[model samples]
Target: MSRFGPVKIVYSDRFLLHDTGGGDHPETAARLEVIWRSLKKGPLAGNIEILEPRQVDRGLLLSVHTEDYIFRFEEACLSGMEMLGHPDNRICYESYNVALLSAGASQTGIDFLEKGQAPSRVFCCIRPPGHHSEAALALGFCFLNNVAIAAKYWQQQYGRQRVFILDFDAHHGNGIQEIFDEDPDVFYVSIHEHPTFSFPGTGYEEDRGSGAGDGYTMNIALPPGSSDAEVLKAMEDKVAGAIEEFQPDCIIAAAGFDAHEYDDMSGLAYSTRLYGHIGRHLSAWADIYCDGRLVSILEGGYSLDALGPSVEIYLGGLCLEA
Candidate 1:
């Protein structure tokens, strides 16, 4: 069966698009603006549902972040000072709330699929990516683990024995991997730059999950100069196999476009064309294993030139409905 089917693209008009804004910032409103324009011109725009990002209550955030960490993050946000990494990721208090709402969008999207209000393929276009953020700490450009929280949320509500998470960020999703490492219920797979040369450095093949969770976590650490062909090979050989075995109730993707060579921040050489391939592969896998259920959350991507087109290509492969 072809995984290609009706797809829902989720987004909000609120400041969710500007969680951490700055002049000439790599991740900025302009990125979403281009994506919006592109989608509007595409046939899929009619089927798209533009929903306002809802605030994820403290309880929901506490599902992945510690209470103390949450309090501090809230405090830092309220203080209107820079939080998380350098000023690049600094955010005002209101921006933090917006980030929370962006995360909340993921939860809402998952719920929509579970209820059959939409198709299995869902995309959340909100920003201030979360794969870099850990459970109790914020790093990179992320403040909260959006995809991780969504996976846990699904597990609790559906009581699913196993859930699969695929993170394709150019940089490793160290935070999510660490958070779910010991839990066998979540299978975490990532294909990223080797830890030796990348930030947050932790996706080594040897860093498999511990205890009963061993082998549930798979990492494909490619060297900095890896090309599109190598990346695609890793996905087909490694990621596809893992998903077949895990047989998850749902699939969540930490989708990042920074791996594109156009992105100055990453050294890996992938063209936007390759991302379409990734999207197509994910669509096929979702069709076979997860009842076509898939949720894709933005994680990272610095170059707008590449970022904008990459999203368009991915959506095309997703087969949005009329």
Candidate 2:
């Protein structure tokens, strides 16, 4: 096994303050709690370092979201508005600042990797989960496109122009794909449930990138009830080939666990162990092409019982060599 730097988890308790309004919301703060508790006591217990996020300037959000949208979302939260565009997007008074903190986790991670800090793997446990957030619209409980902003920040701030984003969320990242649909500098790749049978319904294999980014975007849609085998094949062959061809300078992962067999959010039936495999693949990829630089942002994963163990195993795979 190849050795690497320690793993750092950029997080803040304030992230839990972004309440999903009320009543059995799947995107609850408890998601972070369980994962936090598990990391403290599970197999990899005390093996990782958890750091609070930095004070990220709100203007950095403009790298991905429109200025009008940035102001509108903040106004809605502070003005006591219940939901933004959809009922699925329930918010509380603290959501605006909390979302900034969520996005800040990634910014903190970028600072470490870009500055050649000690940590090689940084995972941001954030909420108001992005990937569905658009330039000026909010969808699927997302407020800001966190991963997209990180990609832009890596490009504009640190000059890591070729950013390879691997999203293994149960649902396709419509907002992420749309944000970089025509930009070749950032490559967005996603593997999720077939749009015909999933929420938001956008990722189609035929929907290749347009214009300069003609072939950068790749959508690997799995049929309902598809299991780990299908996903592994796609990753080993298709995803590996794509990353090889692109040769990215950095790698970002939208790591969502809702695709697990125990989670009811999607029709896909992935086992908890599948996540470990994914982490190993991504870790190896980062080592090979990015000098062990990998930043993963959490997106979705509701089954509280399964989330802890799944995340732990994935983390184990991540720092396996370290």
TM-score of 1: 0.92
lDDT of candidate 2 at residue 125, scale 0 to 100: 81
- TM per candidate: 0.92, 0.97
**Clash pairs detected, candidate 1:** 77-93
- The clash count of every prediction, one per candidate, is 1, 0
Most TM-score-accurate candidate? 2
Candidate 1 per-residue lDDT over residues 1-322, each given as its tens digit? 1233345667777744454556666777667777788777766666566545577767778889898877777788887776554665677767777788778887777777788744556788877788877877788878888888778777776665578888888999988888888888899999898999988878899989998888888989989888789988998788888888888888888888888888887778888888878888887787779776788988888787788788878867665332
Candidate 2, superposed: residue stretches over 4 Å from native: 117-119
